[model samples]
Target: MDLTPYVETLRRELAVAAEAGGDDARELAERLTAPLESAARLTMLNVLSAAADEITRELAPGSVDVRLRGLDPDFVVTPPPADSGAATEPAGSVEPPRAPAESDEGGTARVNLRLPAHLKARTEEAAAREGLSVNAWLVRAVSAAVDAGGTQPRTAEKARTVGQSFTGWVR
Candidate 1:
């Protein structure tokens, strides 16, 4: 399902909440609008699924019992018990394994790019011809270019610290 409407609703709600915090907060929310829209567009389904998974893990460590309001009446997902000879780790102890750096496993990170309209249209056509999603097609093209040593050398710079950003959802 297209989630643009839902995202717009969320953004409107955010603006309303910020209004309650007075002018400064409202201005900040205005500044955040573009980034928020971009994020929602990019990570629509993944964000929702990840949140549900996290909630299940927190509530029932080794098992999940989720029920969608109008979908499934019995949709339980139970993991193997620790003592059932399953390779189980403690809840929230170990981080999940990372895929190889260049592997096209999925969108582990989001990168925004700006291309000319003509270039974008051509790229979409090329992607369609190759029977690949636009993202996968772009990834493949970039990988080929990198492999062919087509990238310019970059000057080294000192790494800088970054802070976390959060969006809280309360019941």
Candidate 2:
């Protein structure tokens, strides 16, 4: 998304706020424009908007509310309600849910992992050679690893059987 216009709007707002303080404040605000623009470009829009709102509150203390445009209308961005019950936790205090046990079954879950580009390429190559999707190949590999207690040596016979099982299941 093109953030240039949004950055410009923020710069203008800051400049107006600084003008109320005098020449030094205006100059400082002007100097902040480049860094602010960089931050806006690098950050996700919702996060950037939240941060900008916080900064506005700090600077003017309830006199100004900074709201970003172009977000979905249905997406309401508001502060979390103050905790009033045991069931409610303060924002940023809750822990993310732990991953399920490896042996757990039924529903599938998605996980994101960062792999080196070359490693990803090699895995893709191997998956292509096996005529299987990367995800299916990885699932089989992990299942095999667990079943074999991580010590079984890879052999052509085992590989052939694994491939056959996979194709048979697909068919």
lDDT of each: 0.54, 0.52
Residues 23-112, candidate 1: write the lDDT tens digits. Answer: 999999999988888677556555555664554434332233334443222335543223432245344332211112434554335589
Error of 2 at 109 (Å): 18
TM-score attained by model 1: 0.31
Report the poorest 10 consecutive residues by lDDT, candidate 1.
161-170
Single out the weakest 10-residue window by summed lDDT for candidate 2: 162-171
Mark the regions of model 1 whose C-alpha exceeds 4 Å error after superposition. 1-44, 47-107, 151-171
- Stretches of model 2 off by over 4 angstroms after superposition: 43-122, 126-148, 160-171
> Tens digit of lDDT per residue, candidate 2, span 1-171?
356677778888999999999999999998888887767655656565565544433332111223445632122222322234435544434331121233444433457868899999988886666444455456555655565575755544433223123221111
Clashing pairs in 2: none
